[model samples]
Target: MAFLVDITSHLNHLNAQLQGRDQTVSDLFAHMNAFQRKLVLFKEGFSFSHPNLAHFPACEEMRRDVPECNKTFHKYRADIETLQEQFKNRFQDFYAMQPQIALFTDPLSATVSEQPPELQLELCELQSDPFFQAKGNERGILFWRLLPESRFPLLRDFALSMASMFGSTYICESNFSTMKHIKSKERNRLTDETLFHLMQIGCTNIDIDIQSIVHLQERPQVSH
Candidate 1:
């Protein structure tokens, strides 16, 4: 997997970074073990949660003994077991908190009026809702329609912020590329304010009317 390759490639650097922070090699190894465990758990969670990914063969390829995967099972077996145990404990914790979660979603429905909301419940409810159920399948915004912004302002804002979050640097990189074109070597003296507006106009999808602006003023004559 790419994650496995990335962690392995940076293992020395990661160890060095940990050492600089006054952490020992043993601690670093433990963290690395935890990281691997978390990675597997994350993959399993994705496969289990996402309907489209449920049937994805690649999601379960790590468990296979294929040449391309070439995963070292013995190296990770102990850590994997530990991670699974932690996952089970976490699941149990959530199961124990279901009553509190239900109280949070519909506070009036709670047996005890003073019960607090559960973070896990809110998130679980968000994902389980029919509107949001299909979102991760191919990316949809039906959840927006179902959200009661005025009624649940905190939940609404949280969902909207998460929805707007960029999962990768593609947009940032594209903007930088656009800036290089807009503020070229020939126009290197452009101010930050000028560059910003120029990039905004160049990068955005909004329409601009050059003719309308031209018609607002007389054209200047060039001297021969």
Candidate 2:
């Protein structure tokens, strides 16, 4: 799972680095690159190859778009789309182990009978998946809300509070990444306490900024 997290971050980094323009979508045949090529050759060894398992759908569409792409490399590049689709389905199955979060229906979102459906069905599928019933905890893209179906109200409340406060473990990883980027290994070594302080400061600043923005967005200024 940590490997998946790093792969996601690195893929985003690679995408930004490879495409200098604001509106370009070029998939990194990253493993095919000289540096990572050797590592990517064997999918089972390292995590850098994980991105190859998650190529975008748009990349496949490009095959029909570009009539001239007849080379072997072009065909291999198209594998990205297949890999991405596979990743989504595989990931869903893996996350399905979370315990059920039974909640009363709000009926706010559109019903299946409605003209335009909303995420109500998706939520239904989410809660129904065996993933939640099997495991007590589940993680998704951003937050990991505690499922409310369990009998322990205190446990549910604590989990909800932590999920709301932390949102995702991504923020924690971001702090760790920042710590790494801040100082080179060759430089003077810092004590664990110092690094701890840095992460504490970073989290504090982020919390304040997020709260301020949320508060500002909640209130609209009226013209006098």
Candidate 3:
């Protein structure tokens, strides 16, 4: 139970990191790569000869009471291996697009030879430019957008396509949740048109102009 709790806690943390807005495929891939590396470290930590529970506080706590906790290390190691396999299999598509992802994330370091023939010259020029070299520090979608469309049309378009790729269903799921909240049983009478506008207002960051709207409305006139 302690082992399960520790593993679940780590998984939950990764899930939370994967959530949120403005996250491009590159950002999600970076998080996944980091988590995969952590899983490797975790597998090593579960070694029978030298158990390392630094990251697994629950397991460490149980070890204090039960020194024979190392008995479960083999099972834990197997589970970690399974997890590693699952992650690799699940993100195989991402692995296949790694070259494109690398180009989008770090054009400065990307190999010009690996890129498409049309993009090769543009990529070379972009990499050699001192102005872009300094600006290359910016990451993900924004970095791709920073490229001048007129200068590096092919490279910029390719990078933008990769950068625009959907990394997760977080935004879609969040919108569904917001929609559910807006059309709750208490507000079941809301029409589709009203609901649409309400959802737009609810999901958007734009501030409503209440005072201006109130002033524009026709007020009831008082009779003397």
On lDDT, the leading prediction is: 3
Name the TM-score of candidate 1: 0.36
Root-mean-square deviation per candidate: 13.5, 16.2, 4.5
Clash count list over all predictions = 0, 6, 0
Better of 1 and 3 by lDDT: 3
lDDT, candidate 1, 120-154, per-residue tens = 45555555666555554432234344657654565
Candidate 3's residue-wise lDDT over 1-224, tens digit each? 99899999999999999999888788888999999999999999887575899999998888889888767665789899999999999999989888888887888998988877889999888889898788866876667777788998998778767756778888889999999998989888988998998789888878997567667868822210
Q: Clashing pairs in model 2?
A: 96-131, 97-131, 98-131, 98-132, 99-132, 100-132
Query: Could you estimate the TM-score for every candidate?
Result: 0.36, 0.29, 0.81
Candidate 2, residue 91: lDDT: 38
Task: Assess candidate 1 and give its lDDT.
Answer: 0.49
lDDT at residue 60 of model 1 (Cα atoms) = 41
How do all the candidates rank in terms of lDDT, highest first?
Answer: 3, 1, 2
Superposed Cα RMSD, model 1: 13.5
Q: Which of candidates 1 and 2 reaches a greater TM-score?
A: 1
